[model samples]
Target: MATRTIIVPEGMEFIRDELGYAPAVRVEQRLYIAGQIGRGSDRQLVADKEAQFTQVFENLRQVLEAAGAGFEHLVEVTSYLTDMRDLPLYMQVRDRYMAGCYPAWTAIGAASLCGAPGYFLEVKAIAELD
Candidate 1:
């Protein structure tokens, strides 16, 4: 099987140079996306909870797009939140992006993530391309 790495120019420096990992890797019809945090194109974490959640999904969308897939193609989604209290806000943002098609999902409460201060959440997804 051939593996294609999905590279996002805005996120490549840290994700590839610093972290040494591809943001997404596609093999066969399946694409595996790395855990995406609420960071801007510049790699800085967003402050507001709602904005952070949006950024996380936006990042996922970018990777999926690069892989020739969309939200509807997502087969599974896993989200990690530092605070479960933000679930309501998360659902609101998620609905805005993924209302029509719902994928199997898991939400986990994380005490902390990657030692990044002010980072509150991370989302990872698996997509099956048509």
Candidate 2:
């Protein structure tokens, strides 16, 4: 049986403490990262669309790093956006962090995310670790 290990990076303890969920989980060579938003260290949501998209990727990066992984390790990624019109901006910001690493991606238009307005994006991913 593969043992499951919860991943909560150095600065993400509040996720488990307050949200009652692990930011990421590792089972054998696979890591499942939870949905990450555009919130910063203080958990305040970023207001600008472009900046929020960047922050969303940064949040995902933090979870990947916690599992000793990176964008290259990502095998699949699912992005939820409140507005489909923001797809171009999302892709642009995503490209900046993804660079040459290409993973299976799916972007969905969502009515709302995180159960609130102003919260525009949420990203979740699965990674394969060596």
Candidate 3:
């Protein structure tokens, strides 16, 4: 299968050249998204946990949309959090965006994330298109 990089708009291509990875890569019917942080369009980390969480999902949405997919196409998700105490809040924000379409999920607690120090969480996803 041929692999293609999903083109991201300016200021949002966080991983392409910096991390040596495409923000999202499409291979046939599958779209693999890199871990998304809570950074705003300005490329700065959001301070509030809920706000940051929302931004993370928004970032994911952008990549999916670029690849002609949506939340419904998501098959799996992996999240990394700086604190497990934020799990409840994270789930609440996640449910708000995810609605009833559930996907396989895994959450991990990490000592720190790469990027801004205020970043509390990051999310990675896999989506399958029909």
Winning candidate number (lDDT): 2
lDDT of 1 by residue, 19-119 (tens): 88888888888988999888888777899989999999899888888777889999999989999998888899999889988899999999998796788
Indicate the residue-level lDDT of 13 in model 1: 58
Candidate order by lDDT, highest to lowest?
2, 3, 1
Order of all candidates by TM-score, from best down to worst?
A: 2, 1, 3
Global CA lDDT of candidate 3, please? 0.87
**TM-score winner:** 2
Give the local distance difference test score of model 2: 0.92
Q: What is the C-alpha local distance difference test score of each model? A: 0.86, 0.92, 0.87
Q: What is the lDDT of residue 47 in candidate 3?
A: 94
Q: Write the per-residue lDDT of candidate 3 for residues 10-100, one digit (tens) a residue.
A: 5666567776778887888888898999988887789998999999999988888888888999999999999999999999988887888
Candidate 2: give the clashing pairs: none
lDDT of 2 at 125: 92
Decoy 1 TM-score against native:
0.91
The positional error of residue 72 in candidate 1, measured at the CA in angstroms, is 0.7
